[model samples]
Target: MPDRSSPETRAVLRAAVPPARRLLPVVLLGVASAGSSIALLAASAWLIARAAEQPPILYLSLGVVGVRAFALGRATFRYLERLTGHDAAFRQLASIRSGIYERMLPSAPDGLGMLRRGDLLARFTSDVDDLQFVTLRAVQPFVSAAIVLVAAVAGLAFLAPGSSLGVLACLVVGIGAAVLAERIAADRGARRLAPLRGDLQSAVVEHVTSLETLVAFDAAERSRTRIADLGERLARATRAQAASAGAAAAVMSALGGIAVLASIAGGLPQLASGRLDGPAFAVLCLVPLAIAEVAAAVPVAVAAWRTARVSAERIATAVPAEPPSGVVRPPAAAVAFPSGAGAPTLALRGVRAAWPETGTPSGPVLDGVDLDLAPGERVLLRGPSGTGKTTLAHVLVRFLDYGGSYRIDGVEAAELDPAEVRRRIGLVEQRPWLFDEDLRQNLLFARDTASDDELLAVLDRVGLGEWARERGGLYAPVGERGVLVSGGQAQRIALARAMLADFPVVVLDEPTANVDPDTAGRLLDDLLDAAGERTVLLIMHSVEVPAGVDRVVELTGRG
Candidate 1:
């Protein structure tokens, strides 16, 4: 569990608060809305009691008008309050999510392995959303209610001091009781709700994504049982929180009745002594009911605070305050990438690196790796499994930081911005991710300005053009994770995407890892041929190295 006072948690909570300018209208409107409700009730009470005396019609005109005005004001202000409040909250939610995403970028892919896909989804989508309540349900309502409560009590004080004191005392006691009930009944449940919800969501995602494997292994029923068990836990927690909220509302309702009784009892003596008129006494008795309604927001606000705090803590835990070890952090003033080249020369000497999750360099995956790629050269990098071929690929793209010297065009790669380095050198992972969209949409993301003819041409270059035409041009669906395509075809599409990107140097990491043995040789040849003079670092393991132009280097996994 993350401490609520941790800097990361505090930062996340702060992001939930919209700018004062944006939130001010919400607060002001809420104050007006709650104030109108109180005034409307008071005005109605006065009008009804004063009418019983058979006063002239003209004498009742002011009271009737006051009632109408307050009623209209209440509805109008309430509508504006909701609109502004929700607007501010939604804007703040966007800011909070953007901040979290910006922080995650430095540790994405490798460093974020600790976050499972379902858990990450819950944190990013669900937990971040809960922070919005900090404004909507908690701060806005609490501030507005407090102001209205104070003003209502003060107005009563001027009318009948005794009744005012009684109402004030009842309010204090009632609010205290409500808050106490909420804390006792719901605090634990509110705190547990976020994590439990996240757990359940994660289990559902895992079960759905792995349903095929579960059924194949005869464990689908078991998985379903686990999901059911998680859902039950979440439901129980939700019920406990709901019950607590109901208890608080019940306390406030009981307080309202007690307040009305206290007002009547205190006002009766004044009524008989002629100090208080019938209209004033009626106002005293009826106002507390409206005030009690406004006061109901207090316990609910407390609950919202608890829930938001837990969500903030979870967000802080999900995205680290700082990037972990071995994760690349952009320099404060990064040097620009060396410009002017068909393909820049790449050189590395004594380079060492580790995955970000390792948290230290003591167990480096790639140690003392020395390799060089001349301009427009095609090099084959061969190694057995676990020889750090993929690690080297990641380093070349600046996904993971490296030690020692790595230079591009004789300029130190570390000094250049990682984004700039990535623009120059692209990586096609062994398993490329294809969005579940038509083929054109997938290729367009690489270079959005590419024409349809250009896309077809690149597809042809990577041996996917004829296949794409058969499927239906660029409109064919790739399915989620490219499940609709074969392993070899997926690789070809990935290469097509790279070709469209037009990186100066491309790192192909185990491109044939997923294809059958007989097809691997042909796929490798087509991929290299598609390179057409761009520097290529082809990483291969278990597959035989095809005849290449420049050179072949093998990593022995020895420092």
Candidate 2:
């Protein structure tokens, strides 16, 4: 078992199982299919016995025909049953994936950032695939197995009440064997499998993302060695599960064989004495074996459950659910900074935030820093590296947590809905993100409804109108992460996105770092001209401050 004492693991279990209420129909269908299959098997034995006896030729042919129909009917129902169960599994997996992504949005950046890209990729893909298989196969097989066991008992009871007791005893033995197999194999299997999956994913992701680095460093062999290790771990887990399942199957089959042998030995005398029919006696023997076959499948299914539970728990713990409905408010607003001391547009006071892995400290990244600005005020934040300039911007946006108060427009920032809070601030990070889509779509990311004229106007404002026109206008594809465009073009396109946001405040960080000197100069000129009606807080590293009557706050000192 996992260390459920960890709050993160507990949270994951809670989230994964919450929406699992939809699994009821899947259970019902599985039971119905298994029960029908058992019934058809028993009917086939009876029909076969009647055909062997010297009955009318037509009657024997009819019995053969009936067996064929029964087999076909069982196949049809089995297909439908599996289809319904798998469909639910897929939907639940999607919900779990979505939940994990939502949780990552608000998690500690340091903690989240520490995770390997390959591990997360494995979780979203193969781990998710395992979940679908587990939910559909694990629970359904047990459910269907139970139904088969119960129906077989009922059939035996109707044909020969005394024999039903022996069959029930076999089921009891099978259940115990299945439980033992699950207990012995699950934890070890999960331990081996989880890391194996994560490593495999990490290896592939590392190779792809660091292809340039790898080739530059001449380290392809090292990567291949690591992948081989991961494969070995996966093979070990597979072998362990297979061995446990083989043991369980052996035990269940032995018990079932004993039950069938005992029934035949005890009932044949009764049949010879005319107390039981040969046909009914034959069914009693065959039905128990059929139930045993299904019971044998249970051990494999249980082993899968181990892997599934681990996957579910991992996803649940990593993803954050929607917090309770009411908005949470911090106690007080930050002190207004000396610059533009009017009603503060954004403020932070006595704030501290850190990872759970790191104990809460008196000094956070923001470190109780106080800042304030008025509407339409252009403030440049110039700080030495590692002084939490970016962290402060995130705190202002409420993307990160802090100890004291952060507020917008005098109201505590926490009081406002996160979605509503974001609407007021337009942010640009150092790296400009462009999609594989057309230039127009990348620019109008959150505002798809913007008309072509509206999009062109914003591009013009960011000094990209002529650039777009040169590339066949807005419809030109930028390729993935704007690979088709130059670094300067990518930045301009990002600036166009921020400009079109039309929020009252624009926060841009190191926008010119990636651009050429001429493009950077032109971009600065256009941005200053377009800054006519908005508050622009720029965290600048290189580009000189636009010549304007605005205050500059220099952040210095270190931890």
Candidate 3:
């Protein structure tokens, strides 16, 4: 298993599929397209000059046929190149996205907490999209251009190697311009990466997360100023990159002029010596443009490659360093546990955990913790603030990788796939995430085909039946993150979602924290009633343990 936090994780992630295999189709098509384009330009130039001389139709026939064939081939190959390139890039992007998601699974909300939501969104969305350069604007074009350039120069040598040297000289000048453009683009790339460094993105996420609070505090003006500042900075950085790209484009156009002049200068001597025919001289003058066109793409390709590298570096932080051994292999079919069935055996000893990349010197958040829950047993996990109560809850759900022996059904938890364990041991976090969807949609998210009766039953179990019924039944929209509902109502809806999953064991993390004592008691009682024979781990900060909880386990807070 590679350490995901290390630099090598990027390499490991990128090697998920064979590189050459994925790139072959796009590269082949691109090379064909570029080759055909060069041939078309030379053929058309020759055909036009021969026709102007009033040569016999048969003498011009070969050039005319060659021009037509190259034209058709160029267009056809270019269309195929785009189709192949985008298709391959999209497929690679999908796999990379899924791999990133799976790698980030164990960390969950805590891992997400390490980075701001906005920055993280940038990584998962934009940064990942930047990887399309693996084919689209980077590798395929770079390789194809090199091949086409070589072929063009080699063919020009047959007419006059002396003139070919001039074409080669022009290529050198074009390359120098591209290199200069890349240097400028590289500097701007550094500036562009700064906005995603948590400051700018953090503000965006914070203002949105606390929009209501900011409005109450009358800090909207302050936030707007900050956002404007960030926007301006980002805009300046973007313009710098665009300017660099424009410079590269200008170099391409300049290369065309330079190559054309060199062609005339180099080919005129060959024409005077009678070593090259007039029609052939026309070929020499235009052929350099083909090679120039390909070489001119170097600067943009370099910039695209750099952008992908920056994105890869940022996204590497979110990918776990130590992926489990078997994650690459498909998981075996799951063994189903009936709803409300008695729980599997749960045990832990010398358990410890810390956020992987947080660089916290205080060590593991939860240390040397020990607990055991018999089938159908209910346990309360109690601790002070920052004492790792939430960590323990996450451990129970296999959300966090821990230091010691943690097992379910007498098998080590590490031995089971984290995703598979989550299927059997459902968790309701402190702050549940509700999508902007109808009640039925949210409930059905757990079990897609769950009957309406089952959904209504779970809502009743979580004490949200009246709430659901009064609010346009199950089809009623819940607004963004359930903003339309009270804190307590949101919590209940999340609980209902879990109830619908009906795992054999459940871990409730501070589920009643936002409600009044009486409401808390009622919710707790209702949850216990709903659990019935199922094992439960109730993680709470308060000492108000409800009746019927089997036992209470306090954190020793020792490593």
Candidate 4:
């Protein structure tokens, strides 16, 4: 299946930009910088011409001063453009990161589960950083350089027409060669980055997540060796990219030399024929040198262009496992689950699915499965490892594709809209994630606008109200993944977040896996008690199902 976010990702990213009015200052700065570059070149040429004519001391001094001021102005504009452009790029990247994350929440078990932690980190850090180059440097530098080149050519033509035309022709050829070189190298660059980046990310994830295990098993050396191997591969790939960029740079330099030579050849003949003077001839030669700076940016532009496309392709391939098409509707109109008997029911009839990579055709994880849960039914799903319990949970949430028919209040689950399915269901995975923020922010995961009263109420329901109050309540930081809180407390916080969603269906994967028996029982009681008006689907491996759960179902086979 293709990712749904690809086609529209560019559009979504663009929407994050500031208004045109806000960008006008940046554009004006670019114009000023370009004009300054041309002026600086022209002044330098005039200074050289005067030095040769009679070496007028006053003109020489003034010209030097003028050139310095021009350079300063150019530098100032360049800095301002970079500052504003990068600022805008970072803001847009933040918005893009958020959007991608939001889209992945419900589709996580389907697509995100397939990604390594390090690769996903790359998406937020490296890939997003690459876009800064694309948005700020890639396009802007080319535009500014082109403008300066055009202005320089015009100034040269006023002094020596033949030389100006010669330089322009050479520039055209140089650009063409650089573009061709880029095209030839782009595919190889992408291919080289693929396994190399993937391997590095994979190794980093494995090493970091298993650091304790590796040390305990005395396998740290082995892990370090594997990381070293990945680093070497990455270095080789980077070298290849650099080599291609170098070739393009060489081409630009060679062409610049040819252009300068042509200018000199044309100007010298004009000077001998009495059509040009020595000072003017020297000025004409300076035109090509000024134009060369513009050509120098070509290689960087090419590299940035290739990198942006590769980054886009990587992100597009990862999110939205299946392409988005028509608007996705909910599985049920109103808390419908279990099927025929009405009210709100969820049921699966022989649903089957297989992981794409392994190509292992397992039986329908819920093989000929039949389930019925009424409103307020807190059912505990019991199964052993590899029994497809997790897979079943994902299907219930509409993340994975299923073969057989599954219905929510008679509506086919497949026909329901994805966003609607998500809005109607809340999930608490085994490893519940909490961002590095305060408890208040974490509790508002689904409802950012949730009131203080609502937040406090949910916290109290999860049995953390008193503890949180003592620790400063909402203002207290939770650290990364609720590290500041105890395992049982984190579990309760996660439950509170899910409960606060007020969704019709709530799903959890081994919520008590890390909690003590007493806490686990208390947490279960809190969840079931609060679920008075909602349905709960608890996925657990242990046979110790919570007392008073509405129902219990067991899976017999491993698929």
Candidate 5:
């Protein structure tokens, strides 16, 4: 059995059920359809038996009309059941996906980035679909089956009291078998099927996305073989579920058959004694079959519940809980850097930090780092790749935590509010993101009410002023991720955003990463000129720090 109190289990159950008011009509329609089906079959038997004795046409007319009405009612109600049920399911699934996405946003490119791309895709696509089945197939079917069962038994009780007891006996046994089957298979369903499906998804996605790399490296056959192995495991899990479903169906059938035969056996004596009529016996026999049809849904619901619960766990793991709301934000006010002695120094003493790997501290990515950026100082921090240069930049903006003392204007770094700290220190990291929006909207992220003159001035600093003027000035589309612009232009646009922020401390990580030496030199000069007296930590490689009014510090392995 699933741990009913587990958070994933609770979430899965809650998402699958929706509100009772919304699902009531769906369940009631299902019950109506099942009742009509039972009535139609029973009426057919009554008309056949009564007509065999040559009853008058007038007497048989009611039975014939009942068969017609029940038949049409069955079809209409079944259609309504499907239509109503699917509408609710769609609405519920949309809400579920939206909630997951909203929770995922705050943790983006951090907690969410830990999952492989394939696993993430599977959760949003296949796993979400599996959860949808819980509402549409699992929960709906069970509720419908229950209501119909109660109505069917009540009808039999009015027809033949003695046979009603037999019918009830049959139902209990049939439903009991289904419940037992579910209990036996629940754990296996969760333990085996979910992981296999996720692995298969990851394998196929990895192979497809990396096909070019595999072929170039001559590992195409190897990737194909690995995919086949994952496929085999998935197949096994599917077969196991199918087997369990088949067994549950078989058990329900066996108990149902026994119940029907028992009802008939018990009815023969009533018939012999003239206590039950021919039509009543036929109705009694048919009632068990109708109830069995509803009872059979139990095992399928079990499987769907298992699938959805596993999906819930995966989704919960992928998106961390949102941080508490109503944060005490400091009042927005201009920060005046202390300008007298030492010029608002940002000092670090024996700073050590590491990027976390799997919830544990990784090998020191930043070690024994000591640095200071006094106000109006433009420091060029030169380093080789993977030497924690960008990591250190992350540290400066409070994006990461560091050991030892870090002070800005004589205040502990950790003691300050993170949001205000970030506002005071701006960043133009390597490969900055640009949405598919016009240039004005992009600049608004840095300053919401920046005037036209201010925007144009910064754009001109990045040498994109003429480009902007030619393309509708501040309203040109930059396409997705600025794809319409050249690589150098994208970098320049990012630099413009940082310049517009006008923070006291600014960090530029590889601002010239995509430019030629001549272009890079020119861009650096433009940036430094625009920067003016702001304290800047510029991380660059290969190119010399061009005539900057600042000193260059080259990192050597440590920190």
Candidate 6:
């Protein structure tokens, strides 16, 4: 575990704070609201005491107006405070989430393999959301309470100095004791709750994703039991936290009563000596109750601080300060891609690379690999499992950095920007992802300006035109992860996207892996024909070579 006050954690926490301009209004409104509350209580106390003396109706009329005005101000200011405070907090949350996402991108795909999907989702969604409390529960309340407490004490001092000092002393002691008691009772539970909640969420996500496998293996009941156990632990921790907060509130209430008694005792002498009027003494005794209400925010603010600190630490841990070893980072100064005509030639000699790994390097997954493809040529790359064929594909697209010479049209690939290299070469993975959207949406992302007719033409080239029309043209849903389409149809859809992208070179890695042998042959033929004049590097394992390929290369596992 890292320190909660680490620089990374501090940076994350700082990002949660809204700018001073936006936050100033929220603080001002909070102060006005809390001040109105204290004033409301004092005015009501004075009004009642003054009425008991049978004063002129004129004096009572002013007190009546004061009471109504303070009451209305309290409610109105509170409403404005809540509105502005939440607005600023939510806007800051958007900025923080965007910053976190930007940080995650430099180490994505390969470097983030260490994080589980479910736990990562929790960090992004739940942990980031907790940061809003920095403004809502901690900073705003703490500022408002401090300002109101000082004003209340000053007003009391004007009426009865002795009672004022007593109230101030009681407030300090009561707040300190209440915060100490809450920490003692709930500190451990508060610290454990964030991680416990993440664990339970991860378990639930894993169970749901693997429900079919669990049912097939007769382990579904066991998984259910594990989820139940995690849920129970989370519930227990939540209850403990609530109990501690309750204890703190109880302490504050008792202290409020004690302050009232102390004020009354101190004010009696002044009242008897004609130093203080009856209404003044009443104000002194009763104002402590309102001040205590303001001071109650202290314990709640402390608790919010604890939770926010934990959440910030978790966010920092999830997104590392630097990209992991073997992950490629963009160069500080990169050259433009070389100008070329038609398709560009790709050549690789003595290229060695490895996937990202934590700690010490485990040597290269691909070593001493040599290959080349001329413009407008088609090549088939064959290898058994674990031979790094897919690794070679990743290297070509600049997804992973490599050691030796890989050139595009006579220029070193490393000198060019990664984004520039990707524009020239595209890859369709072994398991191509289709968005849970209609056909046009899925294809439009590759080339957003492409018309429906162009999309349909590309679909026709990939042999999905008739099949797409039968399913209601381009409006039919692909379902989540392409569940609505057969494996062969999914491959065709991916190929259609590649065509829309219009890359000079495309690498197809195991496109026929999911389809049966009968469909695989025809699918390969259709894909190759659609590729036409573009350079193609087709990666497969133990599949018959489709016709019209210009060359064949094989990778031995030794590399």
lDDT of all predictions: 0.89, 0.68, 0.76, 0.72, 0.76, 0.88
List candidate 4 segments past 4 Å from native.
1-32, 51-107, 132-140, 143-151, 154-158, 165-195, 239-262, 320-360, 401-425, 517-539
Stretch of 10 with least lDDT, candidate 6: 354-363
Q: Residue by residue across 1-559, what tens digits does model 1's lDDT show? A: 1334777778887889888998889999999999999999999999999999999999999999999999999999999999999999999999888887888888887888777778878999999889989999988999889998999989988988777788889999999999899889988888889888888889999998898999999999998899899889889999999999999999999999999888788788889999999899999989989989999998888888888888999998887778888888888899877877689999999998988776554688988999999988888888888888899999999989999899999999889999999888999999999999999999999999999999999999998988999999999999998889998898888888888888989999898989988999899889999988889998887545686647889898743
| Counted clashes in each candidate structure | 0, 4, 3, 9, 0, 0
Best by lDDT: 1
Reference-based TM-score, model 3: 0.82
lDDT of 2 by residue, 159-182 (tens): 776678767776777667666865
Show the lowest summed lDDT stretch of 10 residues, model 3.
322-331
Worst 10 residues of 2 by lDDT: 322-331
- Candidate 3: residue 393 Cα off by (Å): 3.3
Off by over 4 Å in 2: 1-25, 57-69, 108-111, 161-165, 178-187, 213-224, 242-259, 319-362, 366-372, 402-407, 412-415, 469-475, 516-519, 530-532, 547-549
lDDT for model 4:
0.72
Order of models, best lDDT first: 1, 6, 3, 5, 4, 2
Query: For residues 393-436, what per-residue lDDT tens digits would candidate 3 score against the true structure?
Result: 77777656788898787777776666677777888888888898
How far out, in Å, is residue 362 in model 3?
A: 5.3
Q: Model 1: how far is 80 from its true place, Å?
A: 0.6
TM-score, structure 5 vs. true: 0.76
TM-score of each: 0.95, 0.82, 0.82, 0.76, 0.76, 0.96
**Candidate 5 local lDDT, 367-411, one digit each (tens):** 888898988898989888888887788778776667888888887
lDDT of 5 at 27: 82
Residue 133 shift from truth in candidate 4, angstroms: 4.1
State model 6's lDDT.
0.88
